[model samples]
Target: MDAEHIRAIAQQTGCTHIHPGYGFLSESPQLASLFPEGGAIVFIGPSTGTLRVASDKMQSRALAVHNGVPVAPGAHVSSAEDVHKFVEGLGSAPFPIIIKALDGGGGRGIRLVYAEDHIDHAFRRCVGESASRRVFAEKAFVGPGWRHVEVQIVGDGLGNVSHLWERECSVQRRFQKVVEMAPSTLPRDTVGHVIEAALKMARHLQYKSLGTFEFLIDDHAKHWIFLEINPRIQVEHTVTEELLNIDLVKAQLQLSLPKASLEVVLPAWTMSPQPSPPPGYAIQLRLVAEDPHKDFRLSTGTIGPADVFWPSGRGVRVDTWLSTGPYYRGGLQWAVGVDFDSLLAKIVVHAGTFQEASARALRALRETRIAGDVKTNVEILSGVIAHQDWSSGRIYTQWLEEKVDQLVQLGNTQLTRQSRGSLSDTAAPRRLSGGTESATATALLQPGASFQLSLSPSLPQAASGQQTQKHTLVISSIGRNAFPNELSGTITTSLSAMPLSFSLSQLSSIMASAHTEFANPADPSHVASPIAGKIVELHPALETVAGDANKGSYVRKGEPLVVISVMKMESVVNAPASGRVVRVGRGIEVGNIVAEGALLCVLDVTDMDKGLARL
Candidate 1:
């Protein structure tokens, strides 16, 4: 949204074109208008008018309604009273009402209000999250099998538009898409209606460049509601491109030409009488750097090039910003820090059938190996693809959340099975593949670091009342790297003469535990921040809990205490147990950055039942 800075840079560098590739200023009408028509520079995106209308959720909903498209029951709301009235108007339609920002996307600035008391908090959070300070209330379409579908469309400034097809994005976490597949599993006729609806809106507005028309389908697949239009390319655009064998970014550039048209930009589609479904199936998985075991908390650390491995083949494609060059300070090492998106890369696979695609995706995930202190969603992605429900297409937006525990267990079991026989019987350290010896040495034993290695007999030992032998290894020095895979190091170890053996996985586990143990707070009374992020809002009841004389506020277990915003997602920190807040951490307030493991508050558990408090 910093149009002036971008303009100044473009002018200084003598650049003639600016392509806002999704996010940030991609949907900013003000940014698009900065480079006027016939100017020295051109904005490779929709015109200012189209951006203004499409970026506003309320205006887009009104446009959908005017064009005879169905939209959920909703109204512009500025206060809790307006939200209550909107809910009253719905009557018995639905219990949970959704509060959303008027101009938010990518699942941010949204809250689900399930009761009247939560309306005010959700409303205030939405207002604070939105840049416009505007919000809306709508009846939520709670479903056991609801699906999120979107149509890919491209148009020129002259009102000519082409529908590229639709994508099924039902697999999501916290309203953010996790997996997307091209050519929805819905019936042909149902998809046809959605495509036509998208084209109608795009043609009416003469929408130029690429955009997405999002919709929510009911469980029965018999009804759908217009959600909103994303007036820019999305993260899932790779799914559509892989399915159709076309370059969407190239197409966007071609359409921005002075005299571009559908016939010139896409001759293959113009020659056909109607838009035909592309052959084959393509699935894209969003590989994020997060820990599913910790409620998808963002994982931050330096991931060396030798610490990770990527899958590649004929039909598999991995798109990421990771590289191994001196241009970056870390040189191919992923320095995943806080205050940024958790997305690491997108792994896309294409096959002749859905089953084949799923199988290939599983194989690719199994081949992926990420080590060191960083964590990823690769295991969770594998679990989802291998689930029976996923294979049978019985999924919805909330399905992952409901089955996360089961899926995590399944993924762990699969991993265990894969590594069952990986250890060798020989009493020697095995060399790990895809990693330099120096890098491996650096990972296992840094200079002056001490580690313990337990040694067990390679063969059955005689029954004895003695403890197993242990070795204390200390790293003395790590000489300069003279070769890529050569390392000179001295490991002073106290070892006994015995047939002993250990595996590489054991060493890796020790290294990981040593690095991450500090992030887990030891004191139970201290409420620690789960991840590094900014505290956006503090609980109202916490005001009186800051003093010693007040006795603080009595909060029950699972009650919210603070809301933290990180990586464009909001996470609520709830009370761990029934207790009174006796102290708030110094400098912990709204808009304050809180580090992981930093104390947020202190809880007084005098009134909490012992049994209840343990929970």
Candidate 2:
């Protein structure tokens, strides 16, 4: 919530407490100072000193090291020159070190350096990123394998704290965790050690409110090392809640003040481990606002006109800020108009075991769709779900980076097929009527004339490589008053009529054995707006086509018809080909869904004899 808006509401409702829920101003020292002087609002969190201690990575590391917590061997370099000095001292250090930002939130200001060549570049990048994002840097940890485990503990404002087990956050993309599960795949004894260490760290710092102690578990050695302590609620809090059955939020709100200890019993301390394992599995995939095809490029803006199918079962929960309808579009795209936002819709699942829960989550994601100019990363997510490495729990942090190429190809292929408007397997096209009219052997005819024309072969062959097929039309005077000397009503023709182009839609219908009409391009009729996007603007049209070509204008195929812009990118409307307009609507403009082949304007190319003879 906006601070000012919350303050306004606080004044109206006479509310006394303002609890900042993690991130932003939640951990700010100045907020605590400012709120009290205002007289009404009381900020609920740790004091200014606790925040200051927890905010700096170097200080936290030193504190943890002093308390007998195992930590990675990395030096904090204040400048590029300092990095060189640190590098010199480390004569035989291993490659592929992680450089982290001191003040970075999330994984934004981190870099993984592989070799000596990358050292300088990595240092420079981290320095710039940290400075700009207000983060600091740390050297990477080299181990056989690495697993991220986090322990959650809440203080009673006095001193007592309770543990809420640990969450395994090993699965990642670009160093950012995408999937997290409670009760890591680590051994029971290992978990117990980590939990005990976390409590010690918490007690040492006298931590208060909801906090998580992070650790990097060594792959081969089975050793856990303290990384840092997040003195606020984490994004993966739901996972802890699922396994522990504890509402950290409610607990935080209730025990925020400097109150005495409560006698309430917490939920079952930790997840129970079977002698073998659980009956099923639970896996979660983070649905970020990104295009997985484009190297997982952050797709900023309203992510969807989507439907939220809440995954249900004994262990399914969707913690999202969206609901049914277009209102729930994700991501707050700043450049475009308002109505943009992204969320960490924590979709959780519980089953007899891990495999079942993973299956359920996969199925739920497959059923999801976003109806708008925005596209989703569904394909990549699905790929990850089906990946053997992921299924077997053999995934690493570099998994996504390795599979980026294949995922990009697959996603792009899907987009190409979707854009072509090929709704089905059949690629054949239908034909339209009134191709051409023959010249009369006797009298001259004006260009503006509507004639009922017949075709020798009503349907034309499929359009092949820009080579157009011709239709022979026979046209004659309808009444004796119209043509006095014409033989009967239909005049015998020696020459064939000019050819009229049939659009993809018309060809489709004819191929499907449907009745046909003449090709009329001028029908400013709307068709199904094939692709989905926001309508930006419609160009001013000066000409309108009527059914009769001689009396009205004709629109050529591939001519600009309408435009729909998706995600701020513009797309144009076009005429299929040269055909007479039958009925163009005046109100047809931007934001209108022109159903496939809906008539635009009416046009009659009846002077086929004159035009065809020329052809």
The top-ranked prediction according to TM-score is 1
Q: 1-615, model 2: which lDDT tens digit per residue? A: 355666678778988887877655575555555566236666676656667667667777888888898877767776656656666665686555666677655664577777666666556445544533333344465433667888887776556666777787776765677778766767767777778888887777676677888888775677668888777888788776665556777777766554534345343323223222223444555665555644443343232212223445567777765454477334332121211233426677655556666666666664444422223566666566556665676655566667766654553444343334422222212111322211111233322222223233223543232344323222333344333123343335433344333211111111111121233332334333333334444423314332222454445555555554433223455654455444554334455432222233433345334433433
Best by lDDT: 1
- Score each candidate by Cα lDDT: 0.76, 0.54
Candidate 1 residue-wise lDDT, 1-615, digit = tens: 578999999999999999998885798888988998789999998999999999899999999999999999999997889988888888775568899998787778888777888888788778877878899988888657689999998898888888888999998987789999988887778778878899999999998999999998875857988999999899999988888888889999998889888777774753465756788899999999889988888876656665656778978999876655467665344567656777888999999999999998887877666665567988789889989988998998889989999888876665555543343323112343322122342433345443333445444563142245544433456566332234343335634445444322112222223222222244678787777677787765465665443656667777888888876567788988878777777656787666555567888777566435543
Number of colliding residue pairs in each model: 0, 74
List ranges where model 2 is wrong by over 4 Å: 1-15, 33-40, 117-121, 131-137, 142-144, 257-262, 268-283, 301-310, 324-344, 405-615
Residue 581 local lDDT, model 1? 74
Give each model a TM-score. Answer: 0.82, 0.60
Question: Which regions in candidate 1 have their CA more than 4 angstroms from the true location?
Answer: 219-221, 325-332, 414-522, 539-560, 577-580, 586-590, 607-615
